[model samples]
Target: MTRRVSAIYFLPLVLAAGFLCFFLDQKINASAAPAGFENIPGRILGSAGEAVGDTLFLKADAYFHGGETFPNRPPETKEELGREGFVEDERENEKTLPAQPAGDWISRVNHEVRRHGHYHLTKDKQKEMLPFFAAAVKLDPRNVPAILTAAFWLDKSFDRSDAAIEILKQGARDNPEAWEIDAALADIYFYRKKDYARGEFHYADALRKAKSGDLTRFRRIDLTYHLAESLNFEGKRALALEAYREAFSLYDVENQTPLKETIRGKIQSLVVGE
Candidate 1:
């Protein structure tokens, strides 16, 4: 069951879904014993919800179910250790949360799946997990969480730049104000397509129009970096440096390796601020 959600761990679409993975596990565990046989159907329903979420967040071009998610252009680095790589200590702390929290049923499931996914994202199981998320997305289209995830992972999985671009564009239109939609679209235009001009315009537009206090609320640090990269590409060094700092600061406190190092390098090398 956990194996199914962990499949697209490499995809970026999952990032916007944020923090849903942990709760999914709790619900499943709580229902395991059951007051009656009624819990059986609930368990299956929960799994199905997760599957739909996965499909929307993961895409084949973004994540391959096979040995390599990115064949020609490997990520070379990962960020935040990912939902799959979050520390056990962090999971323990979350488990400590007194338990009164509330959200839509699907949200909780995604949370639990994110927490439980770490075990499944290992080098040995990545091949199996890769296809899992795509299938999940297929199960649920209204699931913005899965849709964005599929699109982003597809971006990483090889050479589907065009496909990725289309996903973001469509997503942005479907969900105009969502920070995730804006951020995802910005990333595609700048990073994948290498069209800094268009990317900068979009990021700036998002930053400008994104609902007052909401504009500053970043769902993904990667968005900040991509925005900064676009600024740099546009030769706006001062703003670029600022964007770079915002992204680096957003890194998860427990994050190790790839994101930490890669972000630092981008800051020092790309941003002109001394």
Candidate 2:
């Protein structure tokens, strides 16, 4: 059986959906929003206008400000950034968070709604909130959480898997090195599209592109282990074994002997035709 990875590893779409619900309530029922909530996009736009010549900085800023003002800069894709060897500032590396200003907006809104005892949202309300997330992605192609959470809700909540896949594909192209987007695409292919081969391919790509410094050791192990699972799903037993071995090597157990032994047992099972 395929190991069902915890939703904790998946994008936190429940919290994301809650955030979107708060925003949707504010947009639909103006009284639900703070006094200047409507002006946020405009404020973000005005700030973007001041960042004209610095395309990279603008992209980074747009990522921080919800991307409402700027058009998608095609030439400045993350792939291009990788090609240009654009290293993020050490300060940026220190601030570890999946960057998404619109999602931040949603988070703040959701928190206020919950504080006021008005957090529950209907299905209809969730449906109404979809467009806002889509628009956020349109504004900022690098909005990882916006793309992920929007796609998650669109597919799971709205039965719009095709739309979700399209969003993820675009996100993959835009953020070429983003293993999270690739992993999500792999999952969508396996579960939603039922394309095991494509799923395996993406999982492999995610594993190949993953850098040890960028991703946590456990996350790296998970990626490799899941790649093995994908290969197994595709009936590539040998590749699966190799992946399991890779996963085992990636794990830095130290005092975590139980997990180390568990992975060892997994490797043994694969080797002995389990």
Candidate 3:
């Protein structure tokens, strides 16, 4: 069974021009704040020049459309997929995706991943989504799903590990004791940012939280292995061995033979010369 720390939903695409036109119409016509709201700096007061509202709207457009005038995304060729290290796009070819009007928070988020998830598998297209993801998080800071998805894209697609770290840090602050966020941060620090010290800290915290919280046995095993990997990368071979042993101890007896053997190999490798 595949395990996911964060859940993602997918959707199809629609006519870009029509979609944006409808979205902008709805947003502009939506009720504005009481009168003096215009006096507030950076307010979206409909009296827009290059105000924050307009800027953000334009930014959102770029985010959604990737600056393309047409909603034309050419299907990937077999060779292209191979070169990009991707498999086939398995989604149904539908012209119109579900409607996710602005402020329909959950629906909008669903639209985000469904619209952009496949693009995220590639380098250039994935980088194009940075603004969109950031905007989504800014719109809903407590949305852990959006935070995790965005940070994952930033780190993996754009090679912007620092940006990913910042996003995850905000998520950690908002959702304190969320092992998923901390665990994700630990992975990024260790693998992407190459900040092993910070990785160790977050990994340890994830372990403590996971043990005390309602984390699944599978998730606990997964985190333990990750912690061991971090320790190994930091050259703490002895500590890594201990972590691997603990992980092996936690595996389900009926279905963990392969995992146990893998952990055993890792432990033996660590202790070979010591």
TM-score of each predicted structure versus truth:
0.41, 0.54, 0.56
- Report the lDDT tens digits of candidate 3 across residue range 1-274: 9765432222223456568888985675576332233234323333442244334434543454444222433333455455543545654353533233456779677666653322213445555666656655554455566778788877876778888899899778767867778999999988777888788889889888764556888788878888898888889988988999999888767674677788889988888948
RMSD of each: 20.1, 23.1, 18.5
Candidate 1 scores a C-alpha RMSD against the true structure in Å of 20.1
**TM-score, structure 3 vs. true:** 0.56
Question: In model 3, which regions exceed 4 Å deviation?
Answer: 1-123, 211-214, 256-259, 271-274
Q: Considering lDDT, where higher is better, how would the candidates rank from best to worst?
A: 3, 2, 1
- Candidate 2: count of backbone clashes, pairs at least 3 residues apart or interchain: 0
Model 3: which residue pairs collide?
11-114
Q: What is the alpha-carbon lDDT for the whole of candidate 2?
A: 0.64
Model 3 CA lDDT for position 106: 91
| Model 3 weakest 10-residue run by lDDT | 5-14
Candidate 1, 1-274: lDDT as tens digits? 3555555665655664554666766666776433234334334565575454543344443332222222222222134345453322232112223222367888678545532222223444334443554444334434556557657656765456676666566556545666666666677777667889888777766665566566443444656677787887888888888888888787767777676677788778864445
lDDT to native, each model: 0.56, 0.64, 0.66
User: Candidate 2 residues 1-274, lDDT tens each?
Assistant: 7898788965687789889988985675564222245445423454352233134333334443234223321223344334422332222212232232345778867645532210223455456555566556555566677678778878888889899989888878768888788888887888888887888888888877877677887777777777777787788888888988988887665646665676688779878995
